[model samples]
Target: MARASDVFTEGDADLKVLEVKSWLKSRGVRDFEPVSLFADQLTKDTVAAIEKLADTCTANKSSSAIKKAIVKGIPRQAVLKPSHAVYRLQNQRFALGDRVTMVQDSGGVPLSVKGVVIGLNTKSIDVVWDVPFMSGVTIGDRCSEYRGSTVEFDSCLNLTNPQFVASTNPKAPATSIPNTPFKPRSGPYPAVRPAPGHIGASGFRPAPARFVVSSLDLINSVL
Candidate 1:
C-alpha cells in the first residue's frame, strides 16, 4: 500500500496518477480516483507524464487487490495435499491402499489425522491424503512397527485360509495292448468227441444209425 507521498518519492518506480486510475478501472476497481496531489506532482513531467501518473496510482491501489482477494475462499484442492509414502503396520505387512495418518512434521511426529494409500512396491507403499499441507510427513514420525492388526473389511467375508493340495494319478498312455491277447489260455472244449454207443435188448444198432445193405452174390442167389 504505497501512499501518494510514498509513490512520488520513488519517482522511477511509480509512473503517473491518471493512468493508474484507468488501470484500476480496467481491473474493475469500482471507486478508483487519482489523488489531486499526485496529479500536480506528475504535471511537471510533460513527457509521458500522464502514463507515469497512472502507474503511481496503480502502485497505491495494492490495498484494493488485497481486499478483493480476501473475499474469495481458499481453493479446495490447494489445501488438501497428496504425495507418495511408505508405511508398515505390525509385522511389517505392506499393502497398497492402506490408509494412514500423516504426521504433523515428518521428522517430528509420526501420524496426522488422515491419509490413504494409492500405490505399492516390494517394501514401500505410496499414499495420498486429502490435506496437501501434510506433505512434511517422514518415515521417522510413522510407525515402522505397530500392533498385529488385521483388516476388518466385509468384501472378503467368505474367504478361507490356505489349504494343502494333493495330486492325483495322471492320464493313461494313448496306445495300449488288447485285453484278449493278455488273458491266460484255458484247455480245449470236450464237445468235439463222440459218446460211446448205447446197447439195446437184441444187441442191435440204434435206429438213429440203422441201415440195410447186402452183397451182390447174396442178392443174386436169393433171387
Candidate 2:
C-alpha cells in the first residue's frame, strides 16, 4: 500500500520537505533528522504531520469564517444568474398553482406581492394575487385583471414560505344506483278456462248445446 505522505503529496505539490519539517516541529516532533540518515523515522513523522494538516484543513473548511473566505475568493461570474432567460428556461421549477412572490418598486418603494400562477406562456407568466393592492377593492380580487400585473418568468422569485395551491378541478360525485332485492308478484285470483272440445286429464270431451222448446208452446197459446 502507498504511504499517507505519498497520497498527500499527490494532492499538493507545494508541500516540500522543508515545509514538512516545519509542520512536524510545530506539532512538537523534535530532533528531526534528514530522511537519508533516518529514513523510517522521517517517513513516519512526515505521514503523521500530513495527516494532522489534512484534519485541520477539513475542520477549517467546515467553519463559517473559512467558508465565507472561500466564497469571497470565488469570482462574481461563477455565481448563478437567476435573471438570465436561458437559465430560467432550462431550470423551470415553477408551474401552474405554485404560489410566487414578486419584488417590485411602486412609487419608489420596494413592494412584495404574493400570487398564484394562473397561466404560463413562452416569455411570461400570468399571476392572480390574493391580496388586493388597489384602492376600494375587496379582498381576494385577482391581480391579473389590473394593468402591469403580468411578470416576466426571469424576474419572478420563489417565495421562502411557499404554500402550494390546490387544484381547481374538483372530483365529480358518483351517480351509481344501488342494487335492490327481487320482489314476487302479488294479488292474483283469476283461473284460466279451457277451450271447447279441449282434452281433459282423463280424455277428450264435446261441449253441450242449449234447448229451444219454450218458443213453440208460447206460439200455440197465442193462436
| lDDT per residue as tens, model 1, 34-146 | 32321111111221333244345556766546743342444332232322221111122323334455422333223443333332333333333333232233222221122
- TM-score for candidate 1, please give it: 0.19
Residue 192 in candidate 1 has what lDDT? 38
The CA lDDT at 34 in model 1 is: 32
Per-residue lDDT value at 56 in model 2 = 59
Number of the top-ranking candidate, with TM-score as the measure: 2
Query: What TM-score quantifies how close candidate 2 is to the native fold?
Result: 0.25
Residue range with the least summed lDDT across 10 consecutive positions in model 1: 154-163
lDDT of each: 0.33, 0.44
TM-score of each: 0.19, 0.25
Clash statistics: count for each candidate? 17, 0
Q: Which ten residues in a row have the lowest lDDT in candidate 2?
A: 181-190
